[model samples]
Target: MKIGLYFGTFNPVHIGHLILANHMAEHSDLDQIWMVVTPHNPHKNKSTLLDDFHRLHMVHLATEDFAKIKPSDIEFKLAQPNYTVNTLVHLEEKYAHHTFSLLMGEDNLKSLHKWKNYDVILQNHDIYVYPRLEAKGPNREAISSEQENVALKNHPKIHLIDAPVVEISSTFIRNNIKEGKNIRPLVPAKVWEYLDHNLFYKK
Candidate 1:
């Protein structure tokens, strides 16, 4: 089996995340796309992040109906500030029969050099990079090509996928929730229900 690991903090899973994962599962060479809920991301600010278990549950709620995409809490048992290389190694050991690949946004590819053992990750597994709308400008194609050149440098393991880009973000959802606005269009129905029931992100 071929698995694509989509790792994220998932402060609250939103439609953008679902779309990306589903596209990877259906369009890519991956048999399954596992949304790995990272407990703590070394590069991200942790103060605003929801608890690991809560984030994991939100991921479950968001992806429950999807057959090819599933939620994983593998990083919960691992050390804090989970490193991608370590997680990949552990997963490889546990699921020896499965070939694993990494799923990420083109934005992340721009800064891939900062990640610990990034070279090792590239050497061991393939990386499927999906497009992300740039914040400063609308030139996605140019930015994507430039970032890909910097990160991949024609690496055979890196694959650039032309998937539909969803503009919604978890931060946008949270801000709306805090302002008592509707997030129905920004998240899965089940996930919206879960957040509403739990009063998550409420001020």
Candidate 2:
């Protein structure tokens, strides 16, 4: 079984997320895409982030109808500042039969070198990158070159996929909700209800 690990904060899971995951699963050879909800990301600010359990629950709601997509809270118990390489190691130990791959945007590729033990990740894991329209050309080129570099030694099985870039970000949705604006179609219905009931994203 091939699983694409789609890691994110997912403060509130949105449609854009579902679209990208679905596109990757439908277009690529991946059998399933798991939404690995991070408890805390070292790179991102936690000020506006919802609780980890809340975020994970929202993701579970948002992806409930989709059989190929499911939510994971594996990072919750891993300690503060969840790291990808560590998660991969844990997953490998827990699910030895599953082949894991990294699914991320092209922008993340620019900073892949900065990640903890990135070389080990590159040598052992495959990465699936989806193009982002908002990223600078240099970033895209860098991602392409990085893929090529990995391809040369057959090191990190990197693949660049063409998933539609719908710019509906959770940040934008949070901002809209903060301003008391309509966020009807931005997120899934179940997520909306959860957010509304919990008053999440309100400053």
Candidate 3:
């Protein structure tokens, strides 16, 4: 099986995340897209993050209806400050029958150099980079601009995907909920219901 691993904190799984995963699963060669819920992202602020179990449950609720998408808690079992490279290594050793690829956005590609053992990741696995809208627009220029860096530019392992840009984000949904605004349009119906019943992000 060819699986695409989408790593995120998922503080709360929203429609935008589902849309991207669905698009990748359907349009690309990947057989499935696993939303790896990171308990604590080393690079992100942890103060505002919801509990790990709560975040993982929300992901399950959001993706339950989708056959191609799965909610993963693999990172929860791993060490703190979960690194992508480590997770990939573990997954490969545990599930030798499956081939895994990294799924990310153009923004992540631009900052790939900062990741732990980033060169090893690029050398070992395929990376599917989806479009992300920037201030100037879609960040498709990174692929070409990085050509001077022989390691990443035109790398066969990096595949740029033209996935549709969804402007929605978890921050937007959380803020809307905190302010008592309807977030039905921003998240999956079940997720919205879960958030409402659980009173998440309410002031």
TM-score, per-candidate, Cα-based: 0.90, 0.89, 0.92
Model 3 scores a C-alpha lDDT of 0.86
Question: Regarding TM-score, does 2 or 3 come out ahead?
Answer: 3
lDDT per residue as tens, model 1, 136-189: 367766665766666574789989889988888778888889999988988888
**Model 3 pairs in collision:** none
Q: What is the lDDT for 114 in model 2?
A: 78
lDDT of 3 by residue, 97-185 (tens): 99999998877687788889998999889999887777225445655465335467578999988898989888888888889888898
Q: Model 1 has how many clashing residue pairs?
A: 0
Ranking by TM-score: 3, 1, 2
* Candidate 2 residue lDDT tens string, 19-112: 9999988999999999998786656777898877899999999999999998998888786666788889999999999999999887777678
Off by over 4 Å in 3: 41-45, 135-143
RMSD each, Å:
2.5, 2.7, 2.1
Which residue runs of candidate 1 sit more than 4 Å off their true CA positions? 41-46, 135-151
Which of 1 and 3 is the better model by lDDT? 3
